[model samples]
Target: MPITLPNGITAIELADDYPALQIETADCSATLALNGAHLTHWQPSHTAHPVIYLSPTAILQQGKAIRGGVPLCWPWFNAHPTDPDSHPSHGVARIERWDLISATVEDGSAIIELELKASPVIEAHVPFPFQLKALFNLGQTCSIVLETTNLAKENIAVGGALHSYFSLSHIDNATVTGLQHTPYLDTAARPEKSAVQTEGELRFQAETDRIYYGSDLPARIHDAEWKRSIVVEKAGSLTSVVWNPWIEKAASLGDLPDADYQRFLCIEAANARHDTRILAPGSTHRLETRFIVENLS
Candidate 1:
């Protein structure tokens, strides 16, 4: 029998392949994949375009990372900074399936909680006992909270990100604000140069990859073509990242179409690089981000 959730939400199998929970409310609708606790679709009422983007050619199989829509990069971000030959790049959380703990509706919003515990496979990669909990609130706005607790006897260092891909009408027409005057590492530059952003707003014209340090303020993506603004606010994070594969690099990604770069932009909230968290045994750390969409006149 299919699982039943509060507020008339339904648990259904997607393509007869993976189990997923469907959330519907007066203001929005969403789909949460059981594997990785991935949220693949979210559409607020009265919006023409989805706030979150899922790649057209994304693989949804077990033990694979879906190309878009807020993939959780836990324990580590990107490749292992110390190990050049680390496999699978961004940690093991996104590939491991998560268990749904509870689902409920409160104040007209659908709230879902999922959990992941360390196993033999996870311990082999991370070598630390840990438990992860993800809480998602879907309404007119989307809020996500990720909490990690160190279950090991010793302190553990952890770094990760909420890799969010947002839909856009055109990449060139969008301007991201609130990161001005921040120092960032330009990873696309040869040898990875560090620089301070002088521009009042960031506009995309080429392949970009930058990790902004000490950025705790909310970032806003204003899309002129779409006549909308997406504001991303966060807590318990000190670093933020912005990335886009413009032309040549986009063509090289197997899960993403070559021309799909024009339709989305990624503004990730992270604790990566020098901001890695050192959690004491039995201590818990939480990273949270909220997304709100506003219509432009």
Candidate 2:
């Protein structure tokens, strides 16, 4: 039987790639892959530029993480904490298939929910057993709700991030506002560097990677080239990750183009570092991020 989607929403299969959903509405248009429930494209009709950044050289094949857009990093983040030598980067969520639970259009916005159940592959990555559910609301703004539930009998710790790659008119034209006065760990440094507080809005010059601690405040990306700003708001998250691969790192990534570093900025909403949560059996934790694009002109 075919799944019936609400008005302006259609189920789509990506040729030889993953099965996904195509959302079209009066205010915006977007594409979401069921593989990881990854949101690859989202562009509002009023804006000339895309809201999400996708790599031109990204390989859309199976079992590989897509190079851009919003990739979910769950269970664990970055490299494996203890098994970094052998485990995968960012866990197995991005490479797994998710089932569509429901789809409905509410008050002009399209809300789609999807679920990822535990499996042998997920079990192989983490010691604890758990499940995940994600909800996407596409409208004047984009909101993602991620809920994680613990299934084991004992308490377990977890951390991860939304890991959003936002499109930019040009890398130099973007500066992130907020996260100032908050402590952060610079991950790009050799031994890693720690700062007591971020001074002001962040600007790009070189490769940047920092994990901010204890900040739940909203952040905004001021895009001078496009004459617009993107507001990032989060709930149930304490850590913020701001990163830019710059020239050298971008060149080394097979999925990202050499000079393409000039095109995007990643300011993630996360639960990482000291903010990792401990969940008891039968308990569920929710993390959400809301993105709004404002035209400056």
Candidate 3:
């Protein structure tokens, strides 16, 4: 059954038979859904068409909807670099079903807690015994807090990220500020050298993927066409992943249509190859990030 949380946030209940969870916020009338705990939709209003398209067809059956907002791709983090046992690319938690343990509203924000336990399906991919909780608060500002507690007796190396696919009116009309004079990994460069170059504002041109490390600067995404700016504030997680699949790679991911690539950008907080945290037995680690939206016109 779907229950109405405090501050007028409604949460759709999850049944063991299905893999769907819905969170609706009153402030912006934003609705977010999780299909098998993978991001299904995150848009402001129902009448407003998704800025990003999840499927090529309409009427997505069996919990498959048009995912047009931020998708939280967590767990094993990214590709393990030819390592078979280092967890799959982007982890197993994306498809794993997370449980909703508690829901509360505080300070005009709706906080919903979700947990993932050691299940048969999850154990097949990630054999670690652990308890993970993701607290999602949606309101004046959207925030997600991920807390993981190890249940096993031994230590475990953990790597993960909250993949947020932010939609834009147009790729060419947007720019990412606050990254001036920062060192970044030039993915296009062979052998991937780290160099410090002063690039004023991020632009979409060619296949770009870089991990900006040791930076706590607030990443702000501005869409000139839409006249909107999304300011990202972070804590616990230091690195940010900025990428746009562009034209070529977009055609490769057959699941995504060609035009969809021009409508969205992936800005994620990730713990990838460079920096990884190893949590000890009975130890817990927390990562937090906030997204504040504003009209810049």
Which candidate ranks first by lDDT, i.e. highest?
Answer: 1
Clashes of each: 0, 0, 0
TM-score for each predicted model, relative to the true structure: 0.96, 0.96, 0.83
Superposed model 1: Cα runs more than 4 Å off: 1-3
Compute the lDDT for candidate 3: 0.65
Error of 1 at 165 (Å): 0.2
RMSD score of candidate 3 (Å) = 3.9
- Model 1 earns a TM-score of 0.96
- lDDT against the true structure, each candidate: 0.88, 0.87, 0.65
Residue-level lDDT tens digits of model 1 in 221-255: 99998899999999888999999999999999999
Candidate 3: stretches off by over 4 Å: 1-21, 34-68, 81-87, 106-108, 188-190
Worst 10 residues of 2 by lDDT: 57-66
lDDT of 2 by residue, 1-297 (tens): 456898889988864767889989887889899888899998877788899999988767666888898988887788877888767787778878888999888876789999988788777887788879999998889999889999899998878889899999899889988887998898999999998565687888999999988888699998998999889999889999998999999989989989999999998889886778899998999989989999987
